[model samples]
Target chain A: MKKIDICLTPELLHLYELTDRIVVVVDILRATSCMTTALAHGVEKIIPVATLEECRALQAQGYISAAERDAKKADGFELDNSPFSYMQEHLKGKTIAMTTTNGTLAITRSREAIQVIIGSFLNKTAVVEYLRSQPHDVLILCAGWKGRVNLEDTLFAGAVVDELKDEFLIEDDATLGAHTIYGCAKYNMLKSMASSSHVKRLHRLNLARDIEFCIREDEYQVIPILQGNALVAMVKA
Target chain B: MKKIDICLTPELLHLYELTDRIVVVVDILRATSCMTTALAHGVEKIIPVATLEECRALQAQGYISAAERDAKKADGFELDNSPFSYMQEHLKGKTIAMTTTNGTLAITRSREAIQVIIGSFLNKTAVVEYLRSQPHDVLILCAGWKGRVNLEDTLFAGAVVDELKDEFLIEDDATLGAHTIYGCAKYNMLKSMASSSHVKRLHRLNLARDIEFCIREDEYQVIPILQGNALVAMVKA
Candidate 1:
């Protein structure tokens, strides 16, 4: 069986051997969810930059920009990291340059893996199906808040483990822990996440609608795979 | 109100502020359990060193050396990391020089904190009570397996969160995650840990007794607090 593991935060990514693994980078609160929604809603591709300046510079090259910092929209950006923002009718076929506090950094850092795929609850089934058909082991890299582990990302990783347990060997404590947590929270995820720091943070910023939208399972049947600095929809084999 | 946080691994310790907080370092599979057992069995003090060479050097100075690597006893050490070894009558009144793959490394790295204390299921109540009376915030530092998060340690950290939730503000997701994991595992911990990688590793090495002993609640009523380079039992007023 192929093996599955979870790197709880990008800061601890160095401890895991990234070679020969399919890295599923998840930032469920907004980043990956927005990317999934953008692709499914007909956006051409997303350029995930690590800094605001990098994202801003892309605008001069005709790329629409979306940037967020500390759970709020950055100044002068066309859009924040809300899934609803990506569904705009005017954005059809337009390429977006995006930068967020955690998700983009996670994508950039996972370049060493055999393949890096974006994962979130919005397109969770598509991600599981993609991994099921792949040959390499899987490492769910959670883009935790500011390099600290968060519940929403961990729960999404756990959902993947629960779906792929039969085909993948759960070899690490982190994987098993995620699976167990998912089992506990799958019934009432919003209630389970009531005490989550990210939920609280988003709630304080009046982004509860974004949280609800991000956690909605299988809302989009698309998988965003990182390809040469851009996240494009994976062509199903 | 005081606050409590769980640093899932020492590698992520940099993200947390350590000053003015009580750092409870736990390696529940054996290291912290052994230290608690030794201290409760009348061992004078324990000097936790990072490497085998340092522990071996202390042996020449009449300190009993205990060392472990990858769940096995290191060669040339006086004892392994099993809690049972610490219970031997001859160990009484002797200071120990100890090194382990995970636990001691956690202790050495947490030196920046205002207080560094050892925690284990063997001394869980003592650790909880001590933290209850302390004025500072608390950080439960798990000595994960070689800087990667492990279930046993994470569960122990969660146990602390569950017990102290009413008194401390859990403002982070890691702490809440741990607390939830503890709730899931507290009923039948061994069964909950049947899928844990560390549990499988220990069982493969015929160390089931050590795991059982280590997980026994309140087997020892001692809190080993670091003072200078030695861990001595805290004198309660």
Candidate 2:
């Protein structure tokens, strides 16, 4: 069986030894969440840019622009980091060039992996199904906040491990650690992470609703795969 | 009250707005453990260089050398990563220049903090005493394996939090998360983490004894402090 592992943060990436694995990038609050929701709600595709300048350049070339830094919408962008922002009718059928604080950087960094897929709680089942079909080893890349392991991403990894443990060999301690954290917190995630610095920061910003919404499992079925510089919904071959 | 936090891994480090806090670095899987033991055994001082070349250059100046990478002794070095290596009579009263895979890199990255202290389970009480005397905020830096969060360092952080919780405010979710992890595994740490990738790798190399020795509480009472590019034990003025 192919080994399944979890990298709790982008900084733990060197341990990835990423020569042959298919890396599933996750940013549960709220980059991948936003991407999944965007595609599910009829957005055409997301071009994940590493910087605001790149996002603006894509806009200059006629794509709809969205940029977030520190979890808030940048001054010139049309949408914020909130998944709710992507649910609007105006976003439907439009291509978005997006930049985020942590998630985009992770996607860019894992470009060298055999394949990079965006994983979120919104599309958990579909992601698991796709991984089960692939022949390669799987690595869940949690795009932790600024290179630090945060609860939401690890919880998502845990949920994935919980779903796939029967089909794959989970070899890394981080994988077991994530599953343990998920098992303990899955019942009432908000209460479990009420004291999380990221959640508190969101609460401070009056975006607690975003945190609640992001944790809802399997809300969407869109499995996003990196194609060139953009993430397009995976189409079964 | 000063905010105190522990980053369970170097990947989690950037989450720290490390602008003005005192960073206490802990790498129980030997670097910080070795430093604590070296000081406790009456070694005069420790110079932590980031590279083996620097250690070699320091050794050329007549300093005794101790260098390690991936938990093994460097070629031609007098000491390996094991704390037991520092316990020998030859190290008594001698200045040693040292470099290791993770801990030294963490200390180097944390040079910008208000203060940086090397911490391990061995020197837990002395570290708490020092923190009690200082007025600055504190951040426990876990020099996790090659920048990933490992079990032993997080456990050590939990031990410190358990000790100093009355005086310092635990302000971040990572600290709470680490404390919870420690609480869950306190009674059976060796068994709980026997499956860890780092531990397994160590076991493959016959270094399980080093892991056991590294996690023992209060094995030493010496706290290593960074002073002008080298880590030396603090002397009371």
Candidate 3:
């Protein structure tokens, strides 16, 4: 059986051999959630940049800029890290250049993988289905806050593992731990995450609704996958 | 109130500030458990080295050499990674030089902290008591198997968080997640860790009794604290 593993944070990515694996990059509070939401709602594609300057540079090419740092929108960006902003009708068919403190960095760092895909609660079912159809091992990479492990991303990872456990070999402790955390939090994720650092960080910025929206299951059916330099919605086969 | 955090693996240690923190280094499957047992049973001191060569060199200075790699004792070493060996009556007053894949590396890497201490299920109560008396932030550093996270050490870290939650500000997701994992696994840790990677590795080597002995709570009342270059049991007032 193929293996399903989890890298709790990007800093520990070096320990894994990503060569033949399908990497599911998750940043549940936002980032990947926004990308999943954006694509599902009609945004053409997303260009995930590592820095705000790179995101800003793409604006000159007519791409919409979405940037966040420390839980707030970066100055001069056209959009912030929220799924609601990406769902606006005006953004249909628009290309977005995005950079965030954690999520974008995780996506860029995972370029070495055979396949890099965005994962979030909004697109969990789609991600599971996509992985179920593939023949390679899966690595759930949680984009934790600034190199630190966070609960929300891990919960999303666990949710996927719970769905795929019967079909995949759950061998690593990180995956087991994430699966257990999901078992505990799936009943009332928002309440379970009331004490989480990232939840509190976003709540202080009045993004509680975004947090709620991010954790809602199966809100979208699209998977944002890396294609060369940009992320495009993978066409369902 | 002081803050309590857990660094799940040593590779993530760079993300944390260790200069003024009290680092609790734990390798529950063997290394730290052996250190605590040795010090509690009248062993003079343990010199934890990162490499087997360092441990072998200390053997020339009349110190007993204990080295483990990939869960087996090194060929030329006098002692293996079992707590029972340290419990023997013949080892009294002997100084041990130890090296292991995970535990010793964690101890040496944590030298930057104001205080470096060894913790395991063998001395969980003593570790909590020492932390309660200290005025600095606590960072439970799990010596994961070769920089990858493991269930036993994370559960041990969670056990400590459960005891000290009310006394400390459990701010990070790692501590909160660990506390939750402890809540789920405390009732039956061995079974919870049956599927753990390291447990299966040691069990294949017929070290099941060592695993059972390592998780026994409060078996030792001693807290092993690092002083200069050796670990010696702290005197309780």
Q: Best DockQ goes to which candidate?
A: 3
Which segments of candidate 3 are over 4 A away from where they belong?
none
* Clashes by residue pair, model 1: none
DockQ of 2: 0.44
> Candidate 1 chain A: worst 10 consecutive residues by lDDT?
A170-179
Lowest-lDDT window of 10 residues in candidate 3 chain A?
A55-64
Residue-by-residue lDDT tens digits, candidate 3, B71-161: 8889999999988889888789988999999999999999999999999999999899999998999999999999999999999999999
Assess chain B of each prediction and give its TM-score: 0.98, 0.93, 0.98
TM-score of each: 0.98, 0.89, 0.98
Clashing residue pairs in candidate 3 (N, C-alpha, C atoms within 3 angstroms): none
The DockQ value obtained for model 1 is: 0.85
Off by over 4 Å in 1: none
Binned by DockQ into CAPRI classes (incorrect, acceptable, medium, high), candidate 2 is acceptable
DockQ of every candidate: 0.85, 0.44, 0.90
> Model 3 misses residue B216 by how many Å?
0.8
* Tens digit per residue, CA lDDT, model 1, B147-202: 88899999999998989999999899888888888889999999988788889999
Recovered native contacts, candidate 2:
0.46
Rank ordering of all candidates by lDDT, starting from the highest: 3, 1, 2
TM-score of chain A of each: 0.98, 0.96, 0.98
